[model samples]
Target: MDFKEKFSTIKKHLLTGTSHMIPFIVAGGILFSLAVMLNPEGAATPETGWLGDLASIGSAGLTLFVPVLGGYIAYSIADKPGLAPGMIGAYLASQVGAGFLGGIVAGFIAGYVVKALKKIKLPISLKSLGSIFLYPLFGTLITGGIIVWVIGTPISAIMEGLTGWLNSLSDAGKVPLASILGAMTAFDMGGPINKVATLFAQTQVDTLPYLMGGSRSSYLYTTNWNGNCNIVSSKKI
Candidate 1:
């Protein structure tokens, strides 16, 4: 395929993965937000009963986000055969602190590896085993190994460096960064650019709460602005 075709194919795969992952993100994000809103005063501990339970469930769902994304991405690429390995690799990526970017890498790796495995010729007797046993087993091992040993370290390092850099930035420096992120979020609403910016903010929430807060506030502002404008326009007509 030519450059454009290759780019399009890659975009398609990524979008497929992202599309499948959205429901999980939406559900988890809503639950998480609700939990936080319910406990805004920070007075409720995990022992606080129903509120705590809801918070825990939300947290668990959020944790599964990366694995689901990776698994679906692989499934998009290589069907059911890629599902197990992709989830395993993505889980490892999360454990190793590589975050969503690493999950994306792991998904692609699992998909391609499984696709390659399918090309191997085995005896008729062994062929049945390939799909049921061998593919998931070996594919997971290889994918998890690569993610943990090869990809994980560099990604963690980069995340740390980025976090540190962002933290070190002066208020003036942060303005430009925040502006770009806000603009990206506002540019397309729920489109790819908006999703990308939102994901970046979500991933950084733990280490850089302010950045995520800024991005989210900007998003809310833009959304409200658009809604109000629509209402006014409708009234004029």
Candidate 2:
């Protein structure tokens, strides 16, 4: 394929991960919201009650989303062998405060690294070991090394800056920002722009619900609308 085609494939890989991530976002977000709703004072998350338990479960889901996104994106590129390395890298990304953008970077790196590794010629006996042993081991090491040593610090700094900026925006500033995200959603449907917007919003979901609140409403509307379009297209009507 041409470079354009190759580049465009990244969108498919991204969407693959994003699609897998939605259920986690939706389910966890609802549970967490419920827990917050039950507390009258909104002082802090209940630590002992069922609400606490629910919040914990939701928090787990939110925590894993970065890994899931990385895992599935690599899986799209390099199949089963890439899954472990991608998740490992993404988990490292989160630990370093790299956010979803870092997760995406981790996924792509793991995928391509694994893909390149698969090209190494091996003896018949050793070839059999590539899938179960060599791939995961080397893949994790190289990918994780890049994350922990190379990109981790810079990416973390960027995420911190982004978080600070998002927090600093006044409520009025949010409307234009939310409107732009909506416009991107409508303009691209489920394309790369939409994916980027969704990832940006998702990164803030746990710490800042109101930001995601705006994205979520538009997301639901677009989802239903897209479903209807799919049905119509299927019917050729």
Candidate 3:
């Protein structure tokens, strides 16, 4: 196909596949964020505690499926032809800690590589070689090299920065911060006061994912407010 046709195909693939996957990414992101917020101690492993375990569970969703996004993006761009190698490249990207950005790079690279390979004017015997050997071999090599050399370091650094910021929020700000959090939690009963407290807690969680592990203890406490509100409503009823 001409350049315009190729570009259009690429665009269609991205829009379609992403439309299917965006919900998963968003849910995964928010859950990951909440897990961090609720269990601020960062839960590097699943053994930290119940809250840590829960947070870890949420984080797994984000981590494990990073490659699926790329696979689908390639499939969207190149159809069934691109799925296998695209997914393979995506998985490789995840293995190197490139995350979704790496996945996208892998997917697009694999997709275009597959498309370009398909266009080669070859005899029937060589066609099989191109399909079975050439496409995957070349796609993987290109995708892997880019992910490892160009993408992995930057992405890993960002992840480290985010985690570090979260860990640092506990230095000397714990007590007064906790009081503000507690008071805010108690004041509005899930209204403005509750929102303020939630925001404060989230800020702490964002900055100290590994220190403010008390965030989840408040879940039960927050539920108490809901029960209390229910009782007040019953009285009015």
Candidate 4:
């Protein structure tokens, strides 16, 4: 395939994963927002009350965010065979503090690994075993191993470094940074460009709230503008 075709294919796969992940993010975000709204004092311990319960549920959903994303991405690439290993690898990525970017990497790894596994020939009787046992077993082992031992530490360090750099930015620098992110996010609605900005913000939410805030504002602004344009065009008819 040519470069554009290859990029389109990759974008499609990424969007497939992202589309599946949106519901989880929305649900978790609502619950999290409600939890904080209901317990703004930050005293909502796990055993406290419904507020704490809401927080826990929200936290749980968010925790699954990365694994689901990775699994679905793999599914987009290699169908059902890729799902289990992708999720496992993604979980390892999260455990190692690799975040959303790592989850994306894990998804690609698991998908390709399963695809490669499918190419191996086996005896008639062994074929059944290969599908049911061997593929998942080895796929998980290899993908998880690479994610945890080889790539995880370096990715974690990079994420940390990015977080620190963002945190240390001066007020003047922050305005420009936010402006750039906002423009990127608002450029294409929910297209690949928008997703890139969103994924970055999601990964850094705990460490860099400002980026998320800026992106959200920009998204809202662009969405409103589109809605107004639609309304105006309708009135002209």
- Most accurate candidate by lDDT: 2
| Candidate 2 pairs with clashing backbones | none
Shift of residue 7 alpha carbon in model 3, Å: 8.4
lDDT of each: 0.74, 0.80, 0.58, 0.78
Clashing pairs for model 1 are none
Each prediction's Cα RMSD? 5.9, 5.6, 12.0, 5.2
Q: Report the Cα lDDT for residue 63, model 2.
A: 87
TM-scores of all models? 0.78, 0.86, 0.48, 0.82
Give per-residue lDDT, candidate 1, residue 128: 82
Instruction: Return the lDDT, model 2, position 30.
Output: 76
Instruction: State the weakest 10-residue window (summed lDDT) of model 4.
Output: 228-237
Q: What does the lDDT read for residue 219 in candidate 4?
A: 32
Q: Model 3: how far is 180 from its true place, Å? A: 23
lDDT per residue as tens, model 3, 1-237: 999887677666655555555455445546666555566555433346675666566565555454666777877766666777777777777676555556667788777777776777878777777766776677667666776777767765765565455345545566654554555565545444454344334333323442233332243223364465222221110
What TM-score quantifies how close candidate 4 is to the native fold? 0.82
lDDT of 1: 0.74
Whichever of 2 and 4 has more lDDT, that candidate is 2
Work out how many backbone clashes candidate 1 has.
Answer: 0
lDDT of 4 by residue, 31-73 (tens): 8767876785763434468888887887777888899989988
TM-score of predicted structure 3: 0.48
Q: Judged by TM-score, which candidate is best?
A: 2
